[model samples]
Target: MANATSGMAVNDDCKLKFLELKAKRTYRFIVFKIDETVKEVIVEKLGEPTQSYEDFTASLPSDECRYAIFDFDFVTEENCQKSKIFFIAWSPDTSRVRSKMLYASSKDRFKRELDGIQVELQATDPTEMGLDVIRSRAA
Candidate 1:
């Protein structure tokens, strides 16, 4: 497993790059574990999330892991269009976790995120995921 410092460095690099692009109207975000340390950083950067979900654990075909999703919204002043930011956390190992972020303005991209997870779940034990897991937690 990678050291905590290295993991944090990776997260920081991604966060910095996201901010740089965000200033130019490009919003790109990366996901990382949500430990106490990371939680503080996230709150500082994006303020409170519009919505957040608790950890959902499941036994995947390849491994057992926990997942959580967070959503943040930014409304453009000119058009009041809402741009979405999604942060997904995946922990394949109890001791190590990683995450991914999606910045989207279209419904298609949002559907794609859910579709990807649905496919993964289908490959594993579907019962491991609650019926309302994705809809209630993510949407």
Candidate 2:
């Protein structure tokens, strides 16, 4: 199934369903943790309509917890009203992704700053990532 919002192609409808699951009123955000090496940081995206942090811990293969950070960097009424955008990192070996830090002047001014940086950096995957914002939440 393809995501209606982000336009990403989901492998199946089940993933789409999971992505569309409604958020709770008291939705939790990111869980930030540092691994033993502490050279890198991990930020797990967590919230309602999916497994809780406690549940994830119970199911994790290693007792060592994976750290993550949540960034509701882009949430708008035009988008899914209850939606949040998160950037989570587990390890350098885990994924290429990094911290949840958004180096904007302020939260309200992130989009503009992001656009400026995008142009400055010449992002290879530059297709306007608000759609990815939805796709990541689905996973």
Candidate 3:
């Protein structure tokens, strides 16, 4: 997992890698969109979400946005470990999908069960998904 305090830039490659991991089922992910059509598509693609936060909100560096947090889980082989994936969907308009963000981490990192299952979860902060942090750097 990357360090949240390091101020890393999110890029297309990272997004692509996330999608690839989702496809491979290496980790689970969720989609947050107010549009019913888009939500339906996401449900069809990713299956029903494990949890949903309809009234979620986050404070960004430049502004505050009302968003929804969709959560999912991925259990490692033999139910050894669990991973939590969160998808943050910012809906400034409340009528469509606008800004999409993603965060994923393991439930536990430094511990393993007697069966030799290790939990390798990552830590993240909402500020890392702030618009100023995610905006195109070229500008």
Compose the digit string of candidate 2's lDDT tens values, residues 1-139: 2223322221232222223332322333334333324322233334543444344333322323333222233345467433343432222222223321211111222222111111111111213223354344534
In candidate 1, residue 79 scores what lDDT? 50
Indicate whether candidate 2 or candidate 3 has the larger TM-score.
2
TM-score of predicted structure 1 = 0.26
lDDT of 2: 0.30
Model 1 per-residue lDDT at 130: 46
Best by TM-score: 1
lDDT of 3 by residue, 4-48 (tens): 432222323334434544455432332222222322111112223
Tell me which of candidates 1 and 2 scores higher on lDDT: 1
- Candidate 3: misplaced stretches above 4 Å? 1-27, 36-80, 85-127, 130-139
- TM-score for each of the candidates: 0.26, 0.22, 0.20
Clashing pairs in 3: 106-121, 106-122
User: Candidate 2, residue 84: CA error in Å?
Assistant: 3.8
Q: Which of the two, 1 or 3, has more lDDT?
A: 1
Candidate 1 lDDT, tens digit per residue, 11-56? 3533453444344434232232223454312211222232233222
Superposed by TM-score, candidate 1 places the C-alpha of residue 50 at a distance from the truth, in angstroms, of 24
Task: Score each candidate by Cα lDDT.
Answer: 0.31, 0.30, 0.29
After TM-score superposition, what is the CA distance of residue 35 in candidate 1 from its true location, in Å?
16
Better of 1 and 2 by TM-score: 1
What's the lDDT for residue 14 in model 1? 39
